[model samples]
Target: MPAQNPTGLPFDDIRHLVATMPAADQAAGDMARARQGDLLKPPGALGRLEEIAIHLATWQGKGMPSADRPMVAVFAATHGIADRGVSPYPGAVTKQMVGAFTDGKAAVNQICSAFDAGLRVFDLALDLPTPDITQDAALDERACAATIAFGMQAIAGGADVLALGEMGIGNTTIAAALCHALYGGEAEDWVGAGTGSTGEVLDRKIAAVKEAIAFHGAALSDPLEALRRVGGREVAAIAGAILAARHERVPVILDGYVVTAAAAVLHAMDASALDHCLAGHVSAEKAHGRLLEKLKLKPVLDLGMRLGEGSGAAVALGVVKAAVACHRGMGTFSEAGVSDKA
Candidate 1:
């Protein structure tokens, strides 16, 4: 039996939850594959669309896949490392962007509206930035657990698909630190010019990541400890949301680099956490491709997009819905009065 806690702290026993996450239904996927063969088309003609439908069926635990209720949740928080000039934008931009999301003025808001998907933004804490991870822990255990609980609540009333996004001024720095810690790479390999930083700003960002990793490398082998030592609240919440979505058997669509970094944290914790997820798009961020390679996720779209806030995932939702429609609405050869090949 999966462990249950009545105190509402989902992250308190995350290992147990991950251990008990229901595996994707292979029978349903097999059935979906059989149905696809019966559809009136050359085998594999539809290519990845057919494959996506089958994958969705397995995660949804049904022969017919559906992405009817797509939800995009964006978590926003402040990072103390922003003071080190890791990004061109100021920390206040995090709150301002949250306001833009709430007012339906951000790019992600417009994308969600156009796609007819629901959007929710969580401001973890703009004014209360996490401690500078180069010198101290980013979040204590209690705060980390609480923030994770906050993200787990993102899927409301049984959303069919969840997309995770984040907004933090210096998150790329944290992401670089986290990736270096998990993957054992140099800072230059994972760091990038986030928010349009370049030249001296980008160099400083890289140096900052290098310094933080050197300071905390010993504790990083433990995923949760690494998150506490170097992750933003938004990053922690995104990880929590991914785990919660998997527990509920709802498929999750990962957005860009920072968001994928959160998924990386979950992947480090439990490899199965990725069974219920798909890469929505490949971001232009440098480390994004490596991250997807690490997760072994094939992206649904690629347009050189690096604008986070779930925009890429929201755009990719259309493709997911189309794939589901193709899976559920197409007619079999018998139903279409067409003869099957021997």
Candidate 2:
């Protein structure tokens, strides 16, 4: 295809970013919460979410965590596993729906606008035109390099927080295949209804995932190869982007099942990959919970959102923003003129 924007940053650049910046130490959060407890409020009146916000603030290395310019990056591409008839919607929907998103007609568009979050779309390997479309799949060296480069550009272009969502009809098939390869289990474990399908369709989808895993077994021993084999262009791209975000010190907000699956694969490759990730929600998918457990992340929401277009992440945007606000907005007991006595 045509040349997209300059490929992602070099591997060394990514490495440098990671080395220079790391997640804030948990000790700091513990200390901050201890201070909060001694404050005038009844112990834990602000609740668990407030503690979560404080923890995130400490991670961000700021008294207040403000994702003032949060940006949403949606990767759209086709999945080879879809050829086995995994999704109810035609694979063509991947390309078409991308158009809807770009034109600002999709539900994601509305949410992004409502929250003032910048929206950036990528075509890792789709047939249509997007703001950025790279030539490599997640498994290819060029693609991985390009994904890192594009992600860096997104970060530099003013995205403080990054949200990842995918838009390929049969991406769940690719997700199931990747999960099986990385976590070493059955595709049926992670496979579930993607883009709204019937029970029979879901079964066919699961079988396709299994078949793809078997067909690509040898290549999948390598993390990148598994991505190349049955993974969708967007899924791999998201993984690369998440890694880049970590290097750049930008927090990554993860969406539902598909994005979680990608995050799991990234974490499997590099345990530190989870450092900057904020789990958006626990999707309704059966394996989503398992994936979260594997990553040791507690989601911010569980609104029963099953939409694949980053809807879960978008919904969680308010809380993340609020957390940042709380860190900065809330007054210390001294500032509020309250006694610090037990």
Give the top-scoring candidate (lDDT). 1
What lDDT score belongs to each candidate, Candidate 1 first?
0.87, 0.70
lDDT of 1 by residue, 176-286 (tens): 899999998789999987789799999999989988988886888888888878998999899889988887878999999999998888888778789889999998898
Task: Give stretches of model 1 more than 4 Å off.
Answer: 5-12
| Clash-forming residue pairs, model 2 | 8-149, 9-149
What C-alpha lDDT does candidate 1 achieve relative to the native structure?
0.87
Q: Model 1: clashing residue pairs?
A: none
Best by TM-score: 1
